[model samples]
Target: MSVSQPYPQTYPQQGAPAPAPGYAPQPGYPPQGQMPGQGPGPMPGQMPGGQMPGQFQGQPPVQPPRTPTMAGAAERPNLLHALASESTKLWTTRSTLWLLICATLSMPVVDFAISSHYAGLDQVLRSQFTTDSSISALTALLLYVPLGVMVITTEYSSGMIRNIFTACPRRARVLTAKTLMLFVGTLVTTTLLSALSLFVSHAMLPGNFGEPVANSDVLTTAFRCGIYLTLATMFSYGLGAILKRSAPAILIMMAAIFVPFVVAVVTGAAPGSLGEKLMDYSLISGLLSQFNPQDAPATGPSATGILIYLAIAAAAAIGGAYALVLTRDT
Candidate 1:
């Protein structure tokens, strides 16, 4: 059977808010199906498309927002309340927090446990450490994607997305706020994991990373990795908003991340040139290659590369999302 489309009914536009009670004008307020400025009145579609306007069709006219009868302007959301709200929302629900907790605690424990195995032999250990640690970092990220995606998909799955959209109304603002929260969450989680890893490595292994490179390079790499992982996680929110279903997005994600390598392996004996070329352009290769630039040995794209890739991913997922949100019936 074919995969079902996410937007079977209607969709919205980018930056638009949710359909509200005339309280606010959303970005995707008027859908393409609704001809601009012709909604309150009749359209000439009686000659071309033959579709009548809302008023002509006896539908209720678009009413202006009701002014607050009792009070002054509504107070803005306070910073403390906003922070608490975002934090509570980020941590309370679903499996994501649990996954994060596990990741946060497990990395150090595992790394420390393995410290002894590679200790003492500095040369073999250094080469091994550099390669394995980079891969290990990526392994951490791939494992984290599902939980990150869940941060968004859970809203849709439980129908809370509609509630969220309704409450906030400004879809872009809501999404942006959510993204900010998620980014913060990822940084917190990644930092926790990184710290734990360091603690474990130092306490358990002590001399794992080799003769420390220039402080600048080390800090730069770490900073870049943090941002990479954070953006990757934020991207999942957009993906979930569009896909709505967790399973399909995960499937697509796996394909985007791993299928290229699989393709190369399967074609290994067919033609060396074609197989190698295919792998070179593969999503996994391209994504991972960014990190290992010039054979420096790392586990994340350059800050710039990650930013570009994240942008592309966000555009695809979020673009489809606004379309369905704006035009489709709730």
Candidate 2:
């Protein structure tokens, strides 16, 4: 058999189109415009560095997600929120409204009745009556004590305290806000009522019983009355917190204000230093010192006594309340 001659093979005339400009062939790569296993290379405007125009380089660093922490929560307790809540509670209660109205009107009504009763008395008697009538303003303290007690006790009674605690787990902070609201409310109300009583008594009475508005004694007495009411309210608030019951707290507060006076009066008639000592440390006596520093009970607490006792009681109550709140379950 004869063997046929091998045919001559032909190749590209332009050497595979010159491999395009700036193109470099990588081992196993198809060509400059094609990928190893994919279709075309990156679209136009793409760089050899594998980045497109206006594209960021490389990948952004990954970040871990955030988580909640106790410190973050504790940092967000809002005192203003507590204040607003207490204020709303104070103004919205019917008992609070009625008690406030009575407190405001009681002084004027009682003073007017006293003045009318003594209208025919001589100037000396009338002046003495005017001086004595100032004590009627203290009557507001009776109402204020109950009001302060109810401020917290009502919440306890209705189980709203649980909600309050939930909203503000810092028990002492909650009590403090309530006390502040009570003090402010009582301060404004009692101060205005005392001033009004003074003005009305002077106007209704005869002779020089009407003192000048700028009288140092009158201004000092008015200022002291405000302080007296504020301290008394705080004292009652402490009692409420300590007792956590309205009736008991109210009874104890009343006893604190009146029992000493009763004992002092009953024993004062006898000849012994016991009665004198009781009168000296009495809360009312301390309050009286604010009105007449000179006439303050010779044996009883001074003006500073009121502050000292109230502060101690408030601090103790707050500590106890905090302990209970933290240790006890809702």
Candidate 3:
């Protein structure tokens, strides 16, 4: 006897539909007769033509970040950007900070000590005291020259000059920016230091031995001293750019600055001789003359003339640096 079919089977639960006739659902296969590679048309949220909404059915959109373009004039960095970059680099370095600190403080400290020394002297002329005090500002050069040289050499040593040149292909513009930055920075710092040193020196000396800080002569001399320091530092900077090595550049700068004194001492360049005339144009000589006109030779270049010469020399050095930057590879 046919065993009772277990409870007369009812497929696909009550009210649930069954698979279509002649089509059997299988685990890994699509519906019968449908192409093997065909999918169930476009997915939801996609357009009928298989395009996503808001996306055209064409090649992928251009990605600007990945696209390459040659740098044009408009793309090149401007002077202001270069100036700001140089300023940041200048102020951020620890060597720059320490060197500047020494340069800034040396003037006031040396001036005070000198003025105090003069205070004890019985016969100190005001000109002599002022002259000594003004000369004290030159002590800062011991730090300023290295500071200037490092400004360029540090970049070279660290291989940063390559990046800088790459960014601003107009190398002359970069050099111009550096020159302006160094000039302004050195000028402002040295001028303020000179003014402060004047006040400090005057405070430590008797009225007869030192001019008041408010004296027009004191103000003018302080400003001139600042100009001297600025120009001297710029000269060192130009040497740095040309040499591109800190040690050699510093050595050359020191020789240029102090060799005259050495020559004068060793050879005793007779007064009014050509050698002596050349020494008169040295940085220290012009500075001394500026501080005390009496120290200047009667027939030699005046302090103003010496400063003009210094300015001319500094301009030539900087111009040469800019030219070399254009011609040489970073």
Q: What is the C-alpha lDDT of each candidate?
A: 0.61, 0.73, 0.78
Question: Which digits, one per residue and each the tens of the lDDT, describe model 2 over residues 133-177?
Answer: 456766777877787788777888889889988878787778778
* Candidates' RMSD to native: 25.2, 9.8, 8.6
The deviation in Å at residue 74 for candidate 3 is 12
What are the TM-scores, per candidate, against the unseen true structure?
A: 0.63, 0.70, 0.75
Tens digits of per-residue lDDT for model 1, 196-264: 454345445545344544444434444555566666665666677677889987777767667767877
Clashes (N, CA, C under 3 Å) per candidate: 17, 4, 0
Candidate 3 lDDT at 36 equals: 64
Which residue pairs come into collision in candidate 2? 280-299, 280-300, 280-301, 281-300
lDDT of 3 by residue, 1-330 (tens): 787656776567787866657868488888875556777666667687666678777947444575455654345558999899888988898877789888888898898778777765665463355677766777987788888888888898899999998878878778878888889999998887877777677677766533335567777887888888888888888888888999998898888778886776667668777677667666677778877767786767887787788788778878888888888888
